[model samples]
Target: MPDENFYLDNDDIRFNLTHMVDLESIAELKEDVGSPDCAYESADEVVETYLDLLEDPIGVLAAQRIAPRAADVDKEGCHYDNGTVTLPEPARLNVQDLAEADLMGMTLPTRYGGLNFPATLYTAATEMISRGDASLMNLFGLQGIAETINLFASDELKDKYLPGFCTGEHSGAMVLTEPDAGSDLTAVQTRAAYEEDHDHFHLTGTKRFITNGCGEVLLVLARSEDPEKYGGGRGLSLFLVEKDETVTVRRIEEKLGIHGSPTCEIYFNNSEGYLIGQRGRGLTRYVNWLMNAARLGVAAQAVGISEAAFAEARAYAQQREQFGQPLDRFPAVQEMLVRMRIDIEASRALMYATAETVDMEMLLSEKLERLDRKDPRYADLRARRDRFAKAAEVLTPLAKYYTSEKSISVTTDAVQVHGGNGYMKEYAVERLYRDARITSIYEGTSQIQIDRAIPRVMAGAFEALLDEYADRDYGTVALNGLREALAEARRSLQAAVAYVNDQKLADDQRDTDYRNLTARMVCDMALDTYLSYVFLEQARHSERKAAVAAKFIQDMAPRVEMNRQYVMSGDRSVLQQFDLLTGAQS
Candidate 1:
């Protein structure tokens, strides 16, 4: 029998698609996009068709084709043997399988041999692949890199690169990070100077800690102007650098995790590169656009890692006997298991909600573009596109921050459940434990995410978005309760903001301590409130989900309140009682 329970619920994704954001009308509007009379099937029909595919053999192929090789790939790792850094047999073949199945170009338009699937469906595929092996997700998820090129690449560039990417003939890498330029990509030292005769730029400098650095195609961010002309982010530009004699792989890093995907230290010596988009706007325009997409990919990777960790811990608890019966019988073990489930479910709910917003935005924009070029009669499509784009802007960072942080927590608990066994390489949790650590660290770290989110939260973008969801006439009683809970949570968050602003502490820039403390409180309350709404929405869609949703809401609501209280209490003990808490000489 097929393991249906291992995958996520389709109804939950659909609920997010329909209620979490307004997708039905957008789907209808974008339906007859390319083909006349090709009306979009119902949202439920779309969800069912996608689910049936997920339940099919293709789903198992990921676990069979990729998951089994995860350990060996991690052990053997990618190597810089000879001039070519070669991937292990399993890693190379897995990419080939995804390509052959037309999954590589999933969200791209069919004109480019892609499936033209919505971003929501692409996220579903991403979650499946991630569940099987978190390491492999890095390679498989490079479709976003290809997406950047497709969206911004010149016609010649797209024709040459995108086809290979879609067919798995080439792999893509985002070459941004360097030894000194970690978080501050504007400090990038890589130089790209244009040649008047050739009209192509020549790149020179070494880029370190690049994911898929050995990929066939590289999107590099380099300074095109005089090195000293740029202060922070100015005078930088995006470049399309291909694998060539001049671009050499100097070395590969043996990283803490994600061993299957090669991380390289690449040296560019007069490598011919084509300028992408415009000059002096690489950091601001191109890289910003690419990072937004990449952040969402990280969120999906987190969900995948969490699922893998949850499965191992859940199975271990059921099978591992302690004392007289299964370890699951123990109250402590049961509590751990429940917490694991709750966290994983909450993370996934947040991730899916984010994906829905992304999909709507992407599809709407595409629809409006097509209308502008080919069908000006459809003006409403343009308006819908703008609305979704705004929503996606606010939701993406929140989802990435929540999911990545949750992955760390879920994987940590997974190790705890395994006890001594988790420490050993014999169990998958050991590898998962390591892999889960990177999600929060990379793709604009959790701190960066909060920095991005603060403005949106303070500006009340999410508050307005939630108002739309609140207006819906939900059919389930449990869902209604969740809405009420979210409403209450929101009220608490608003109160925290008011209290902080009113207090003198909020204005003290010197004391970043208070701001950091308040940011966490506001984010947590908002996250819980958002999650409460998501779970309740799930319950509304299916009776089976009612208990799961209700259980989560009941447990999470109090934590939401507690987090709020922690912030609202105005406890400056960290400052006033700092010396008492940790003296210089104990």
Candidate 2:
């Protein structure tokens, strides 16, 4: 109702395409990509085609068909009865439209009936779909499952399952969690034993908290090795199992948000399964790759939700009257609106930067796999590939962490802007509020992201990345003090990271507890600095963008110091006073 085309209506998405993203650089790396449908005359042609495709079909479909149905889809939700899962009509239609549009297997090879697009495009599409309906994104975003199959599965396995996936005749579920294993996937109790007679494995175990567990295809992580020898994640191997009598959904969870998404408990009993790759590499390799994709998808989803919530709040503020004037005229309300807008913009920048980095890593892997070792370009290209690989590993988690947390803040403020009516079902922001809550919890929580990112940051990889961006001509002298301020922030951040890395922070019982305790502060400072640079990159093209950059850097300056001070102060109150503060029995 508000905007018929989500992509067309958003100027930032377009600006990123035209300004921030260097499609030519990414396309040159993909010049010889052997996928059948990946044929491109030039990088320019690819960019043009991508923009056209987004405007006509992907943009229109998400705004018109999906967003319009989101309300009813959420209300109706999924119906679970007699071990059969049925999606609400509206939700089904939302998914069917994307299927018909041939968008389901966005990044898979064309030989598998896919579009063979880059992850940046896939991620951007994910954001658009999530903007339409968070529930639909759960279903639509399952493309990662298909891509994983294409990547790791044998040619025979790919031939059997992938065409169906790309055609949208089959959907998939990533089955990893168990009752005893939520975040610690190493504790998964699922069992998959090889049956000599059948020459395949038979899976038997329970998987809990699975999204889209009712889908036709399931990628399972199970223990295939002897626990006594290869315990924990080492014993795990990835498997593919289809929906059959032996594979059943026990029950779906009643969630606080994203109600249309079916979070299920599944029981696999003697279900015939095929290994994706080598044994004992499930958690270490295959699932890790899949989870990275899943985390990036969630980041895009968070940004989309933020966009929708901000739109609703912005519209309401302009139209609604309070104290004999429009609510937007009030200084208090205006500040919230501006802050929400800036935060949303910052998160979008972070997410896309991550997505573009993933694109480089993904395409580079494809190229290097086939390149001759003696080729002239091999050495230089391999170095480039490894560099992007390192950046992608860290950025993916940061994108997921920052965008998801920002969505919570943006959505909460949206409701606050709307007053009492925002809490009611009459408005879409109510559902958006619920949908935004899950982004930070799933696909690795914010804490998990910090644990993953800080080591890489301390290794000097992320800072080197920021410095690489610094090489791009600023087009001018970073608006005078903006450059100096960013330098100071970077200095403060480096000192804080050094303090966190110091050996003196160790405790008698646990050496790394201080690092764990003060991690969020270090990560927060890093994020603020990253956001400032991201905005400055945008600030190069337009006066409006320049203003946006200044606003972000100026606002986040104090935050950078606070986090630095807290980390540098060696604050261990959480660890030192755990029992005292929490009244623990022990």
Q: lDDT of each model, Cα atoms only? A: 0.78, 0.87
The prediction achieving the highest lDDT against the true structure is 2
lDDT of 2 by residue, 1-586 (tens): 6458988999988888778877777766655533465577677887787778788688999898888888998898889997898888998887788888888777887778887778888878988888989878899898999989998999998999999998889999999989998888999889999998988899999998999999999999999999999999999999999999999999998888887789999999999999999999999999999999999999989999999999999999999998899999999999999999999989988888888889888788778888899999999988988888998988888889999999999999999999999999999999999999999998888999888887787776668777865556667776555766788888898898777666462253434778777777777888888778888878888999999999999988999998888888866778888898898835
Worst 10 residues of 1 by lDDT: 1-10
Estimate, for each residue in 280-307, the C-alpha lDDT of model 1 and write its tens digit.
Answer: 8899988888888888888888888888
Q: C-alpha displacement of 514 in model 1, angstroms?
A: 3.8
Q: What is the lDDT of residue 320 in candidate 2?
A: 98
Candidate 1 scores a C-alpha RMSD against the true structure in Å of 3.4
Most TM-score-accurate candidate: 2
